[model samples]
Target: MKILGLIVEYNPFHNGHLYHLEKSIKETNATHTIAIMSGNFLQRGEPALFDKYTRAYAAVKNGVDLVIELPTMFACQSAEIFSHGAIATLNSLNCVDSICFGSEEGDVNILKTISEILVDEPNEFKIYLKKYLDDGMLFPTARSLALFDYINKYNLLDISKEKLLDILNSSNNILGLEYIKSILKLKSNIKPYTITRVQSQYNSETIESNICSATAIRKQLKDFTNIDSISSVVPCNTFNTLKDKINNNFDPMFDDNYFEILSSIIVRDINILNTYFEVNEGIENKIYQSIFTSSSLDDLKESIKSKRYTMTKVKRTLNNILLGITKYDMNNIKNIDSIPYIRILAFNDKGREIIKNIKNNSDVNIINKFSNISFSKDDKIFKTLIDYDIKASNIYNLIYYKNNRNLLKGPMDFYISPKYVK
Candidate 1:
């Protein structure tokens, strides 16, 4: 009855993801699986190719026993926040025995060791981190260099600074480290496991094999919109589902889909952007300035991104503004350790049993339907979190009708029920 948990976006549930899922189950020797997935938005601050319910249905159809939604407030955030939300949710599910993630390094020991050092932040490590920051390096770059130096100077691990830097810089490894950190911070009993990422790099945009990156699949969909273009890279369920959607004239969303709405909001009241999350260091002015000259989302990002702010960070900040996630909102729940409720998206018979197990073992609120949320009367953060998820979905619905903007599909979360697979 061991339940394995996976933190994922799935996007379209490609072959690489399928490989990871099978290998994770095999490695963990688990009987059941639960996936805490992102909703309409993703960690990269981009809209998903398909809506949450569609993606969750695909995951359940493939292998995952249960799928839970990661709140939008954390879904479209930095590595730390995203990992915290995911790990906390899994930890709350007391029946989960272990969690698995794909990483370039593929060694839980090394990732765990690094997470320990980060959580402790020994005096020497702080000195090195401060030195890099004082030299004007970006926080991520600075932190990586600091870790490289701290580890080497202390002879913590036998790895070289070059190799260490490579590990720290890799996208999957970074997320893996953060996952480990969250587990340690929460003092959770859930064990951690990692598998080596295969076939393609995280940011690769070209498909060369059956196991290419999600980025490549999305790029193909954006350019061709033909299911055949991505058929080889994704599973049958993904291919057939996408084909059905395409056949019905449904469009896959991309980051640029929200560019017009985002740009308009920024131009309409640039000062208002200052109130949003991560809209610091006068970035609002840069975004406002760039809006007049920039044509597309990518162009606007390129205009505003600098040594102080990486492109990914800038994108997240801009999307946060568009979603109206204020710094105040985040500040309000900084100390709250776990997600307020578990929002189930999809499940099967095995998943139903796991839900029963959760009900008997943990006190965490389980949201089977939107109406169930009313039980949390005294929990302000619960309302805030659910509101953001609903807001993000409504906003995504707004941009989804790019072809016929007048025919806006209103409020999906309230009407859409959790997908139950046989």
Candidate 2:
């Protein structure tokens, strides 16, 4: 069984996602396909356009055989850690033979070369990196400039600095490089494949006719004034599901209410802000100053963001704070082996066969039922992990109406069972 593993956050199952799924299967000759997807929260430190279950079901209905949740810790982090956890989870399955991801460059060799450079971190690169950091540039920008400097200094691969910048700056290519770096770090046997991204771009916010980006689709969803053109980009499954959600008044999450609600939560526990993961460089103090003054998430993030900490970092820190994920809790589980468990989200008939095989083959625990395993009273690490997952779910539900909040209890998310979809 040549199982293909995919790292995804199908914030909504759109046309681009469907295209990638089809191309992945054909390109890899995969017998089974599995996705380790983000749950209700995304790497951007915002709630997914829709809930995980709906998104997972849409994935399976489209092409994915099985869907598993990427834990909250990794899901709401930067690209490097997010890719690390995703690669780790895919590797844990043991039965997976290859992983396929979309990339801007779309060349496996080019992606591999970049990953090698990142992993090796030549002395020249480090010196350049340090020089930029010392100049007070943010880590990402500093890293970018350092890459350019190192490429120029060594003339590595005879590739121009400007050309390399184009590849590195592309969002999917950055993730693709990190994915390769993680695989190299693990010395894993899984093969990697990259498919060229098509049509709309990663950050494009306008809906095109046939191949719009998810970000574009989201913009249309956010403004329901004219949605007729959305069908051109999203599949019937996604379109219908979104329509159902909209008709039921569940489409207001992107509105200002989320930050309004979050503000109330932040004010209630301002003193404990520093304890959460990613709250550093006195960012907690800035958040404190903004919590009472800022009216929206944008306003709060604007107040907290600085030259050292990017806007994404500030938002990610807020996500950590909202869910009570302490830095101590994260530090205790930095080792890849410390990722305690994996939660199955949804699966089709083919997925059931894979699950049966996984029981005998997987490295990590395959959680289908919540009650089967519980962290003992003394296991703070595991408890803290599960605690954040539950808390994140509860907060994600805040986007829905009051009565619909808390739809899934702690056990339901962690213990009850993975949803079986035909």
Candidate 3:
């Protein structure tokens, strides 16, 4: 069985995602597919429009065979950390044959060439990178400029500096590069492929066609756009699910909902902020000061973001603070392979078959029921990772209370189970 793996954040699986899934399976000639998706919080440091299980169910219904979650600790971080965790999760499965991703630059060779340079960090590349960082440029920008300079100085490839910078700048291409970098770092055998994104751009906020970006879908939903407006963009199942949710008065949520709690946490203890991941270089002071003037999440982000700190970086830092994800916690899982267990979210018959194959190849615990974690390899670090996911789920579930005052109380993860799709 050739199992194809995909790393995704199917916030609400749309037509573009469906096309990628179908096209990837055909291109790889795979018999089964596994998708490593983000939990409630996404890489951009925002809560998902819907819960993890809802998104995973849509993916399985649309075509994916299995959907396992990328743990919360790794899910809501920078591109490197996010890709490292996802690639490592797929590697741990021990049954996946190839991993495919959608990218603006669909050439795997080009992406791999850049990944090699990043992973190796040649002497000259290091010199250039250090120079840019010393000049006070943000890391991503500095790295991009450094790569451009190093490649041109050495004549590594026939590509122009402009073209190379373009590759590094495109969001999807940047992620694709990280995916290949992680693969090389681990020396994993899973082959990587790229499917060129078509139609809408990655962060486009307007629907150009039936395959608009998820950002556009979320934007419309945030404005309370009729579900019919997004009908043509998402799958039938997704549309129905979203429609039912809207009809029941459960609106799509965003980071704004947690603003008050986040502000309270920031003002409650300024000293504790430095302990969280990415809350360094005096950013905690800026965050603490911003809360006094900021009225919303976006306001606080704008107040803190600067040339050295990009908007995405600021957002991720705020989320880390709110979730109480500390630098110490991240240090323990520096080696991606240490991501203990596979947390299954949704699956089908083919997915079950893949699980059976996985059990034959690796000793990693496969958990579908939250309580099963107690019986699995018990350790402080392992329990800490699971606790973060549970905390995130409980917080995410809080939004539903606004619509249904009678919803279940307490943590949601304990009562939830992996969705089984026939």
Candidate 2 residue pairs in clash (backbone atoms < 3 Å)? 370-415
Predicted structure 2, TM vs. truth: 0.90
- TM-score for all predictions? 0.95, 0.90, 0.94
lDDT by residue for model 2 over 1-422, one digit each (tens)? 78999999987788889999999999999999999999888888878877787788888878799999988878888888888888888887777889999988888987887688789998888988999999999887888788877766666566676777798889999899988998999888789999999988898998656887878877776777344558888888777766776676565355244786667767777787777888878887788888888767778888888887788788788887776777887776544643556778889999988888877887567667666557442566556666677777777775554555455343336534666777
lDDT per residue as tens, model 1, 1-422: 98999999999899999999999999999999999999999998889998898899999999999999999988999998999999999988778899999999988888988999999999999999999999999897899888888888878789877888888888999999999999989999999999999979999999998899999999998898778999899999888877877676668999998999898788886767889999999999888888999989989999999988889989899889889899999888554687768999999999998999999998889888786677795689998999999999999988675665655546778778899999
What C-alpha lDDT do the candidate models reach, one value each? 0.89, 0.79, 0.89
The weakest ten consecutive residues by lDDT in model 2 span 407-416
Once model 2 is optimally superposed onto the true structure by TM-score, how far is the C-alpha of residue 199 displaced, in angstroms?
1.4
Give the better candidate number (1 or 2) by TM-score.
1
Judged by whole-model lDDT over C-alpha atoms, candidate 2 comes out at 0.79
For model 2, what is the error of residue 415's alpha carbon versus the real structure, in angstroms, after optimal superposition? 8.4
